[model samples]
Target: MTPKEYFKQAYRLDKRIDSQVVKLGELRALAGCAQTISYEEKIGSPNRNTEAPFVKVLEKVYLLENHINEQIDKFVDLKYQMADAIETLPNVDLGLVLDYRYLQGMTWEKIAEVMNADVRTIYRWHTKALQLVQMPENPIII
Candidate 1:
């Protein structure tokens, strides 16, 4: 993979985790909404099923949360890998640019502000940084 593609893996994972969290929140809300589930069973004899009405939704929420946790773990590991790779750059300036853009996932404007440099200069540094990037032996695959 190209350097930019390799660096973006963490960002993609982060976004996926965020989306799962939002879905989990919505699922929790739906599970908690008792009014949404019917209390009345058949008008005839009582059903033999012992399972609670909302148990499925609650289980779904829990499963989603677990999935999100797993994704977060992946994201953390990927960040550490990326940071280590960035630190290996020959030039400190190039390393800083890679760290901000890839590890921290900062935008050009924010990186420029943090580094007290113009956006154009930051872009130049970023281009150079990508050129100097040595792809890790085992980059995290999306």
Candidate 2:
């Protein structure tokens, strides 16, 4: 893949990880909602039936949480690999540019702000960084 594509993949994975975190939060909230108990239920009523549904919801939440955690791990690992690749570049400015753009998911403007350089300079460095990026022969797994 091209350097731009590799960086885009990192950005995409960052977004997916963020969305999964939100989903995990929502699932936890749902699990909390499922735990509510109504004390005013009539005697001998079907209130006991709530346990089964609540248990099922909790189970689903547990599974989803695990899945999200695994996905986060994989994405984080890929980001680390990307960072390693960026470090291989000889130019410090190019490494910084690629790191900010890919690993940190920063915009060109933001990267310029952080680097204390002009946006045009940042763009130029980005082009050079792409040229310097060395992709691994085998893509990182996970």
Candidate 3:
């Protein structure tokens, strides 16, 4: 794959991780809601097999949390590999542009603002950075 496509994979992994994190949060919230019951509330309610479903939900939440952590670790490793590739470029401007745009997940406008350069210059730097990036033989998997 080309450098642009390779870097885009990182962005996509980040998005996936973000989505999973949201799901994990929702699951944890569900688990929390399942666990809370005052003594009066419990006394009023009938004795039913509530533990089975709550246990299942808690188990699912745990599995999902582990999966999200694994995905995040993969994303971090991929970002590091991309950073190493970006470091190979001789132009510091190009490296900075790539770091902000890909590793830091910054918008082009934001990068321009931070670098004190025009948006056009940021785009130019991005293009140069893509041309200069060199990946290893086995490219990182998204």
Best-fitting candidate, scored by TM-score: 1
Give, for candidate 3, the lowest lDDT window spanning 10 residues.
Answer: 36-45
Candidate 3 per-residue C-alpha lDDT over 24-50 given as tens digits, one digit per residue, 9 for 90 to 100: 888888877745565664444576665
Candidate 3: pairs in clash: none
Worst 10 residues of 2 by lDDT: 45-54
> Which residue pairs does candidate 2 place in steric collision?
none
Q: lDDT, candidate 1, residue 65?
A: 82
TM-score of 3: 0.83
RMSD of each: 2.4, 3.9, 4.8
TM-scores, all candidates, are 0.88, 0.80, 0.83
Candidate 2 lDDT by residue in tens digits, 1-142? 6768766776677677788778878877776774555588566766556455557767877887888788778787788788888889999999999888888778888999999999999999999989978987666643
Cα lDDT tens digits for candidate 1, 3-92: 988998888888888888889989999888874566876566476565786788889988998888888888888898888888888888
lDDT of model 2 at position 113: 96
Deviating ranges (above 4 Å) for candidate 3:
34-51
